[model samples]
Each structure stands twice: as C-alpha cells, then as structure tokens.
Target: MAKELQKLFEDLKREMKQEFRELKESFERELRKDVRDIKASMSFINQCYEEMKASVKKVEAENEALKESISTLKEEREALYAQVKEQESRLMQNEQHSRCLNVEIKGVPR
Candidate 1:
C-alpha cells in the first residue's frame, strides 16, 4: 500500500509539471503577439509624422516665394508713384508758364 501511494504521488507530480509548462507557453505566445501589434502601430505613426514634415516644408517654401513677390511688387509701386509725382510737377510748371505768356491788349476794354 505504501509503494502504491508513492507511485500515485509521482504520477501526479508529472502531470502538474506538464500542465505548468503548457500554461507558460500560452502566456509567452500572447505576450509576443501583443508586442508585434505595438510595433506595427508605432511604424504607422512614424510614417504619418514623416509625411507631415514634408508637407510643412513645402508650405514654408511657397510662403517664402510669396514674400519675395510681394516685396518686388511694392518696389515697382513706389517707382511708379515717383514717376507720377514728377509728371504732376511738370504739368503745374507748364500751366504757370502759359499763364505768364497770356497778354491783354492795352486798347481792349471789358
């Protein structure tokens, strides 16, 4: 009877060890799957970040170009304004000279 009891204990120990090994294997597999999912998510986020950076760079370049164009237009406008001012001055001088040249005959009475 004692021998039989010892035999039974040994069998039970073997079975417990087998069950523990299986549980450990299942847990490891689940952990590995979670890690893979996390890696994939990180990869997608990195891709989006890179694309956004590129778009921002493009916008910055366009903005710089617009600034240059505005600066050039302002300079042209200033030059045109100067020309107009000169023309106005010439017109006023011409009118004054013409008035000076006008003569009323001494014998003419109004």
Candidate 2:
C-alpha cells in the first residue's frame, strides 16, 4: 500500500509539472504576440511622423515662394505709382500752357 501511494504521488507530480510547462509556454506565446503588435504600431507611428515632416517641408517651401511673389508685386506697384505721378505732372503742364495761349477778341467782332 505504501508503494502504491508513492506511485500515485509521483504521477500527480509529473502531471503538475507538465501542466505548469504548458501554461508557461502559452504565456510566452501571448507575450511575444503582444510585443509584435507593439512593434507594428511603433513602425506605423514612425511612418506617419516622416510623412508629416515631408508635408511641413513642402508647405514651408510654398510659403517662401509666395513671399517672393508678394515682394515682386509690391515692387511693380511702386513702379506703376511712379509712372502715374509723372503722367499727372505732364497733364498739369499742358493745361497751364493752353490757358496762357487763350485770346480775348471781344471788341472787333461786335
């Protein structure tokens, strides 16, 4: 009876060890899967960051181009204003000359 009890205890111990090993293997598999998921998420985040950086650079370049265009337009506007002033001065001079050349012949006709 003592021998039988010893055999039964040995069998129980072996079964427990097997169960523990299986549980540990399952836990390790789950941990590895979670780590892989986290890695994939990090990779996706990095990609998004890179894309955003590129987009920002593109926008900055476009902004610089727009600034240059605005500067050119301002210069053209100043030049056009100068031309308008010159034309106005010429028109005033012509009007003064015409007024000086006018004649009053009122006594000879009536």
The segments of candidate 2 whose C-alpha lies over 4 angstroms from its true place after superposition are: 104-110
What is candidate 1's lDDT per residue for 19-100, written digit by digit as tens?
A: 9999999999999999999999999999999999999999999999999999999999999999999999999999999999
Q: What is the lDDT of candidate 1?
A: 0.96
Query: How close is every model to the real structure, measured as TM-score?
Result: 0.78, 0.81
As a whole number from 0 to 100, the lDDT of residue 64 in candidate 1 is 100
Model 2 lDDT, residue 52, Cα: 100
Clash totals, every prediction: 0, 0
> Which residue runs does candidate 1 get wrong by more than 4 Å?
104-110
Model 2 over residues 38-64: C-alpha lDDT tens digits?
A: 999999999999999999999999999
Given candidate 2, what's the lDDT at residue 23? Answer: 100
Candidate 2, after superposition: displacement of residue 59 in Å? 0.6
